[model samples]
Target: MKHFHMLLAVLTLIIFVCQALPIWMGKTAKRSAMITGASHLIYTLLMLTGLWLFWQLYQVAGVQHWAIAKLVLLVVAVSATIKALRNQAVQPSQAKAGMMIAAVGYVGILYLAMAKPLLG
Candidate 1:
């Protein structure tokens, strides 16, 4: 399950990069027939797996502060992804900024999940 979850994350990241790069390059990002559907499926799986893992941990340890932090990071990631999807040629900067924010948010979530640090 862990390996599958990790694989999903990597695949999602690859999709994110693929979608953003063209738009960032000032090119029209025409959606491929499968890209949108694949992205949705991948993200759904990734999120579900993450939630299941968190649920298992919660059953044993209750809700940890870091877990809550991770949830917040998830919101950030979703927001950025939405912005990237909505970006147009008029405001390419916003799209790229959103993509960068999402990259950081996803990396942060991965780190938080692995480290599980407590805040003072």
Candidate 2:
């Protein structure tokens, strides 16, 4: 279970890094965004499976906040990717903002998972 969780985390990190790379390189962001979104979808499924397995094996309630936040961010990521792909002329600022929000949410999710802070 631990190994599975670690692998999921690593994969998610890779997806995030890959998604952000094109922006830093000043290339066509849409292509990379699509790839990143797809990677995120894969990561989400894997993470869900890992969480279910962990719960089944250890009866431990995982970080629900992080999981929920991640799902929300993934939705935003997908939406942004779709919009960018459809309208190549869309302002880069909009895409950048969306990506920034998604990245911030991802970081928040990681913090919540690591700290397990009390959820009011």
Candidate 3:
């Protein structure tokens, strides 16, 4: 399950980069039905697996601060991605900023999940 979660995290990054590259390069973004569907499926599975992992952690060690941080970062990352990609009215600069935020959120999530730090 942990391995699967890691795989999903990598895939999330790959898909985000692939979709955002054109926009980042100041080119028109293109979307295909297949890529859209795959991304949705991947995100759904990722969230489910993540919840399961969190449940396992809770059972073993009670609540952890890092896990809560991961959850918040996950929401931020996904929300920013959606805002950047789906909002047709967003300016190019705004979209770029949103993508950067999503990237940082994802990185933070990955770090928190891997480190599982004992934060107060």
lDDT of each: 0.82, 0.60, 0.85
User: In model 2, what is the error at residue 100, expressed in angstroms?
Assistant: 0.5
CA RMSD per model (angstroms): 1.8, 4.0, 1.5
Separately for all candidates shown, the number of backbone clashes (residues 3 or more apart, or on different chains) is 0, 0, 0
For model 1, the superposed segments whose C-alpha errors exceed 4 Å read none
Colliding residue pairs in candidate 3? none
lDDT per residue for candidate 3 within 5-118, as digits (tens), equals: 889989989998997887788765677898899899999999999899989988999988898898899889989988887752458887777888998998898788779889
In candidate 2, residue 27 scores what lDDT?
52
lDDT (Cα, tens digit) per residue for candidate 2, span 1-120: 556766776676676666555654555545555766667676677667755764564456644554555556656655654454344345666555555665676677567567856563
TM-scores for all candidates?
Answer: 0.85, 0.63, 0.91
User: Per-residue lDDT for 25-120 in model 1, tens only?
Assistant: 877577776998898898889889978888888899888888778778877987897777677466788878887888899899889878989863
Which is superior by lDDT, 2 or 3? 3
Model 3 error, position 11 (Å)? 0.8
Q: Kindly state the number of residue pairs that clash in model 2.
A: 0
RMSD of 1: 1.8
